[model samples]
Target: MNYFQIWGIGFILTLSLSLSAQQVPDTGYVAHWNHPPYAMGEGPVVGVDGAHNNFHKLNAGFRAFGNVAEAGGFRVVSVDESFTEESLSDLDILVIANPLHASNLGNWQLPCPSAFTAFEIKAVDRWVKNGGRLILIADHMPFGGAAYDLGMNFGIEWENGFASIESGGFGDLFTDHFAPFTNADSINSIRTFTGSAMSSNRADVYPIIILSEGTLNLPTIAWNFDSLNTAKPLAGYYQGCWTRAEKGIVVCLGEAAGLTSQLVGPEEYPVGISTPRVGGNLGFIQDMLISLAPENDDFMEALGWLRYREKTTKVGDIPFRFQVIDWQRQPDGHIMLSGEIIGSAVSFEENEEDYFVVEVGPMESDDPNYDDRFSRWRQVSEFTFSREPIVYPD
Candidate 1:
């Protein structure tokens, strides 16, 4: 346990130092998209969108999804400020879920409803192109209509309707096995409930979850009528899609409920990811988050133990001995790192034998030939590794 604690010590040194000096900056903060005129603040926090229609972080309606993100090492923040380069500069990701303009929320009908203005959309475009991630959740009818314009900028066309199955039972909307976008066998099970459909035609854009063959989108003035009601048909589209641009990534989900956990009434019937009937939503969302924010590393719990031995190394004529330990594999299949400094020369060989090597210490100069200035010992402060386990030696 002590060793594990020490393992994270390097990662938090700067944070600890800042806290000790009380120099916390409000910038570089996580912000959940919220503007009262366009969004609601039913919760105590002004930026929190607690309205039944919105999915702000502080909203009771979105607690399940919020908790899952927090559990995964992300702090859910509320953003009230308008979208601008300076305002959005601090954020790594911006989430807009089931948003509605102030006037539209009164009746919740959509002839024309803009969740975000043209300027705001341009600002978001600039932000994403500068390496910021965006998550847009537009569920059914009005919500989809509201976010449709912004989706178009990313090459997404949202079908403003309710996604359902052609065979048409209540259970038709409940997908037990959603299709995976890639060839990977990581298919997920989920209940979409009532949501919109989307499609994108950009090279960088890819589908993450596909609604089944029988699925269709049903148009409505409002999401009022039952599945049996006469509605316009919108067939063959994606339930979720993501885009990977040169600088950043964008993920869009048609159904917000699939990622959420909530009760319908006082009876407290489970909905979304919380229901036993629908599972693996957490893994699906986590994968999306990882794709959007590749810089955020997953912490692996250490297993087993090893002993270290001293070995001699040549820094020109000077002989230096350092402790080198046998590599131990972590549960995630990467080699566990020891609290020792090993230079670039031995690093590759170690990785070749271990498949993946975790190295912790200060960075060295890029020059192959070491200089006296670069030879000085710098303490291990942080350890960063590839998102996927390394296969080939490099």
Candidate 2:
């Protein structure tokens, strides 16, 4: 991911910012959320509409970034207001709720305009490459607004197909729950959570949420929102899992159809169920929004990187790194991140050399009691020289 001037800032920010008096950083948003009740779903989780999402959740999240963080806080502004070179310079993070295909996320190496435009790819490249945190919410099978445009940065996409749920109420298309790849039966000593009816090619990842049961199957076909290919939606989530690929962390969907759902609005909400709380759509919206709040370390960073739209190879420790890796930006905007690590360095001659080879696919989200380290490097790179991240193609 490249980060030149996301949201139009005028400086480069890093983890080095002071811990006591952080200022607010310029942040941008992409408009994609558009479901009736507007993409709402919740069973056991607790969420409150208009509470934190705008008034409730956001204020708290920002308080930590702005008032709490030493260097700066996250301030959401209009896209036009924030889109600029200088703003990008000072931008600490960018959140793309559900981006669609655009001139951004492009490829210029092709003889003609690539399937994607260079601008389309480069915007994301510059943002992440420059250490900007990105958060992306992707749609699975049914295309939940604009999710894939940002999802691709991490090598993930909604399967764009159908979905099914067994032993649960609602249609077979409505699923009860979903699982991760690592939680399934072991094959050849490695757990392969693919082709289990719900998901395919699942990898171990920090899953945000999975279908519990009674979830709808996505649209009946797969189509690029940008291209409007309408190729036919694929199968959807059904207690499924998938493997993340590429160099960045990924969150994948079962099928385009699985992500399809109805959103709950103020008029649509029902109150007085949980005493002071509302019931039905309103309650459901609140709970789901809370889940979407990203209640862990640096929610902004995690979400930003997940939706990164560039073409670079980046890997890092979950809570450790809050920004994207540095990479060269392509002329047309698309970035090229390829090259094996330089092996056999003169610095560490012993077994610490294998750290350069640390690579992994998507993470599994189904297991409640799973090891985070298991989804990443098989062996942690214990470099005698910790300061060096040997760069290739230098």
The candidate scoring highest on lDDT is: 1
TM-score of 1: 0.58
What TM-score do all the candidates reach, one by one?
0.58, 0.32
- In the order shown, the candidates' Cα RMSDs to the true structure are 16.5, 19.7
List model 1 lDDT by residue over 47-118, tens digit each: 223332353344455666665555555556666666777767767777777777666665645463677778
lDDT by residue for model 2 (104-200), tens: 2232111111122345446545645544444433323222323333345444444332222322112222122222211111111111111111333
Q: Runs in model 1 with CA error above 4 Å? A: 1-57, 167-170, 173-188, 215-220, 224-235, 296-394
Cα lDDT of all candidates, in order? 0.49, 0.26
Model 1 residue 222 distance off true place after TM-score fit, in angstroms: 1.4
Model 2, runs deviating above 4 Å: 1-73, 81-88, 100-118, 139-146, 161-204, 212-394
